[model samples]
Target: MQDEGIGSNEVHDIISAMDEHFNPRDLKVGQDVQMHFEPGADEGSYQLTDMRIELNPLKTLTVSRTDDGFKSNLEEKEVKEVIQAQKAVIKSSLYGSAAKAGIPKTVVSDAIKIYSQNVDFQRDVQSGDTLEVMYETHQTEDGYIAKTGNVLFAQLTLSGRKIPLYRYETADGSVDYYGRDGQSTKKTLMKTPIDGARMSSGFGMRRHPVLGYGKMHKGIDFAASTGTPIYAAGDGVVQRAGRFSSFGNYVRIRHRSDLDTAYAHMSRIASDVRPGTRVKQGQVIGYVGTTGRSTGPHLHYEIMVGGKQVNPRGVNLPVGQQLAGRDLKKFKAVVGEVDSQYAAKSGAAVKVAQRQVESQDDIN
Candidate 1:
């Protein structure tokens, strides 16, 4: 090696009795070489750090100075426009369902809005909570997401409360809310075309939240939270699913005998169960998301029955089982007396009201 004049900063490669190899360049300050090698031509050891080999991409390897060790701070989400760039990955993935189910892209956008209405979602949702949604999607001939889809189930899990809402039917030709236990949660049919809280924004009315111009609210707004689950307010099938720059993700559910419902602003949906599948009461259909014409997350629950608009709260739900003899008597007495007391008091805001007062009034 000395005869070859390989300097301290240089390296040597040879094919000989030892099949030996020498290091390249002087070891840097505080730097050392680690090696792996084969036995030499006769019996000497071969050194690895001195040799070059094809790179192995699968192996985990690192080379660094002592001044700093590896430090990794990686966030969970990414921003990619294409489908493959999806950052929110899940075991029970929702986008896959939209594709397979033939839901329109717009419907999904609406669903996100619907989900966002749950106030708690924006402030208190935990990492491990589950969001199970069932929605529909339309596809291109190539099986790509052509449009958004309608949500059949949108269930969100929080600390302890599980809000199970449904799109169900009564034995008598009417569709309305039903608890998962098959019990009715509805006091009556939504008098208007939409449900949830009082109209945050009204129909046929206009006032741009941003610009000073006035625009029609078209439908009503129901306050909720980001990531909150939205339900189909009645038994129906998805009519449209697509994205509208203004609407964001949206879904329209068409019901039997000329009834329909619309949900807007959603994050995503469940991977299984599509447009035509029948959904029962209290089904988790979609999650609230902010994607449309307004601020913050909330549901825009709209209903259209008989082609005319009406407040969802005032709509007559028909009557449930007609509270028979004993139950009927008890029910009427109880209900009537309370109404009478309220009518009598009218404006009594003294201390506070008590359930007993109402009960006693009913008994009388």
Candidate 2:
């Protein structure tokens, strides 16, 4: 190769222009070659600060772009407005009654309290009852009753179709339960023996435990957890009990007249339980378990009348005691107020309803 003998000034300028390009003449004919160059200001090249990369302000969900420089799935949300839903007002009215137009009291009372455990209108009711209720709805963010409230005016119907009501004040007030005809359901004892407790098994069935064979189950089985207390099925005095072979850990009670009941297969009997002990209905008699000749855990219950076992869970299961005359009238009045409560937009009340859900981050 011939030396060009270029000017010293030209050589100096070339080295200054490209500092990293040292071996520049290593090219061969028809050979592959690669070269990297740093952009310069003089040759329309830009520094990093001068170069611009356009970016969209919105978030994109598409991995591949379309021909139009936009993805098919990129949705643009329009910012309109958000309206806070208002709740309907809560009002107190007749829930049920035997008077004219009304549902059964027991069924309605059971239905109303289901929402909030704390309700005051439960008291003051009789078997043959009637009621009348009056109350106003409130205004709330989601509406009024949508917010949740107590009884406004409770009108309890009595035996003679008399209605007595206790008004519920909105501004932090005490709740009072009363009956129509100026009567009260709040007595020393409740009418129903069992309230929330569920019956695991009923009297009369086909099952065996000791021999592991199918046999006639004479009594009912209340399958509660081990250590769960068993209540006396009725008001009775403890009779024959203690430890029996087949009826392992039993408690027999003699009730009024010719009625009697027995609880067996108990893990343990209460210390208070003994012969001649007077027990009330719903009182703890024993704990449920797989004692005696039992296959699994259960409460063996039996109800005897005139010294004979009968179906305790018969459809005609007896109520604690039915009230009549003035007592019945007062109960119906309370039911009246509970029935009208549905007027407060709880879904069936409104023609159109929308449920709103907000994330914690969004709400704040």
Candidate 3:
């Protein structure tokens, strides 16, 4: 307001009115602010009459100077939901492949989370594998994507085996990803608790990096940067969440079926997580860090079954709920619709690519 030469009193009144509809402190950096001016009493002078601030792509806050006082109103634009589909062959990583296909990172992350129940991205996802995803996006009147929604369908082809999962809501309003056979994609536990991290070490005998001696490594290590979010492997109650010997920051969750998952070497545990506190699957429990007796930033993850440590990759995790009868029938119809949409979108994309190629040939 000072830079724009608005009087202090007017600025204060304008802000007070704006606060009625929106918080001024919540303004994001680089957000758009528009000011309208009218002729002042003095010649060649202009006075501020109205101000508009873009809260987001879909919302705008407008403050107009009225005869009584300044008044503010929040204007929201309507958006239409659109379904989009993308298919890509993995050349190196799923992130890279999805980027090339113009898929949003959030959608790709959701797909990874859905598949993490059974597929190991680091080990199972190899070059030549294929990924297909169909998702929803809310677009403004101008066709700008305002928000990316859920992944309605996803498919992964590994070594010629195609695994397809469809998003469905049950009669009880529970939503989850289900395979073609109507089996929920959720397993008893996730194979990897964190995303975009490399497995530095596996469970078994290995030379301890800090100890400089061969030792039986009971837990698998995921090497990630400090502060990387660590997720709970499954829905469970926190058994312990504190510092321990050789483990900087540790969190242990006691899950069902006599299974327990432990995360070690966290930079900091989430404030809400504590002993006896129940946590949902894929919930963030802590952040990756080398807290105690460590060499570098990494997560030492372990799965205990019947009080015995086991390799997470090799463990036979129990499958989730199996849809049947009416639920299964509804899911099949959803799958068919998704498949049809994907096919139509894929065909359009192919035609667009062909047109680009022909246009380039003409230019040559």
Candidate 4:
């Protein structure tokens, strides 16, 4: 404001008023800022009258000179909720394929987390597998998507076997994903506790990477980037959380009287997670790192029964939430509605693609 020949006192007042509603530090490069000035009492001076800054696509912050001083207010634009569908054929990874299909990264992450309970992405998701997702997005009046809402439905086809899930809310307002049979997609434990990780090592007798000798590997190792979040495999109370010998920054959660899950080699444990702290399924526990006796950034996970380590993949996890009676009927109705929406959106997408191809042919 000073550079524009406006008085410093006026600039200060304007900034102070804006601060009441917004943080100046949040101003980003290329953001739109509008300023208005009026002639001041001095011969060559100007007074800052009004200023408006675009906070985001849906919000605007305005500061205006008032009788009391300068006043700031926030204005928000309403957005329309739009249901959309996207389908992708996996060429490499699910993330890559979803990106190619123009699916938002957050939506893909949510789908991965939802399927982690039953599907092992590293093993089950392969090339040529088909992934379909129906989700909600909030769009501005001009049809610009302001934000993504939730995944309404997700379907994965592996080896011609289709696994479909629908987001349903029960009578008690509990929301969960259910299959056609109305059974919840959740299992006793998640097959993978972290997202976008590759299994670097499996549980079995193998030569230790650091020790250079064959030994029984009690846990599986998932290699991911440093600071990647690690989630609790199931709802449990933290039995132990702290630095241990070879398992630096470890956390052990007791899910049942005889069942326990352990996560090791975290860069940092979540501040809220401590011994005796209860955690829900999919809650973040720590971040991946090479803190213990490891060669790279990864998570070492183990499941113990009767204090003995067992192969996590071999454990027969119990099914969760078998809907019956009225709940099942409601879920079936939800599934039918989601199916109709998905079909309509998908059909429109196909028509758009066909038109694009025809236009290219005509141009050629």
* TM-score, one value per model: 0.35, 0.39, 0.77, 0.79
lDDT of 4 by residue, 28-70 (tens): 8788889898887789767778889989778899999888999
Runs with alpha carbons beyond 4 Å of true place in candidate 3: 1-78, 358-364
Each candidate's clash count? 78, 38, 1, 0
Q: What would you estimate as the lDDT of candidate 1?
A: 0.44
Q: What are the per-residue Cα lDDT tens digits for candidate 3 across 75-117?
A: 9898999888888899987898899988889899889888888
Stretch of 10 with least lDDT, candidate 4: 315-324
lDDT of 1 by residue, 1-364 (tens): 3333333332322212112221223324444323334454456544232322212221112221122321212122222222111111112333444334333434434433334333223334554444433444444433454444344334445555565434343334444323344444433322322222334665666777766688756566766667766665544566766565777777766656666666677664433325665543234557677787657676666666776655544444432223345543444454454334433432332222456588789999
Candidate 1 global Cα RMSD: 21.1
- Candidate-wise lDDT, in order: 0.44, 0.47, 0.90, 0.89
Best by lDDT: 3
Per-residue lDDT tens digits of candidate 2, residues 1-364? 0123334653344434323322224323543322223454468552211111111222122212223321223322233222111221223343423212322343234223321111223343444554333334333333323212334343334345544333322123423333333332222122223233345555555655466667777776755667777766556689966898888899988865677778888888888998889886556777877778776667777777788887764523232333456545555665565445534423432344322223444676
The CA root-mean-square deviation of candidate 4, after full C-alpha superposition on the true structure, stands at 4.5
Clashing pairs in 4: none
In candidate 1, clashing pairs total: 78
Where is model 2 more than 4 Å wrong at Cα?
A: 1-207, 212-216, 222-224, 313-319, 338-364
| Cα error of candidate 1 at position 279, Å | 2.2
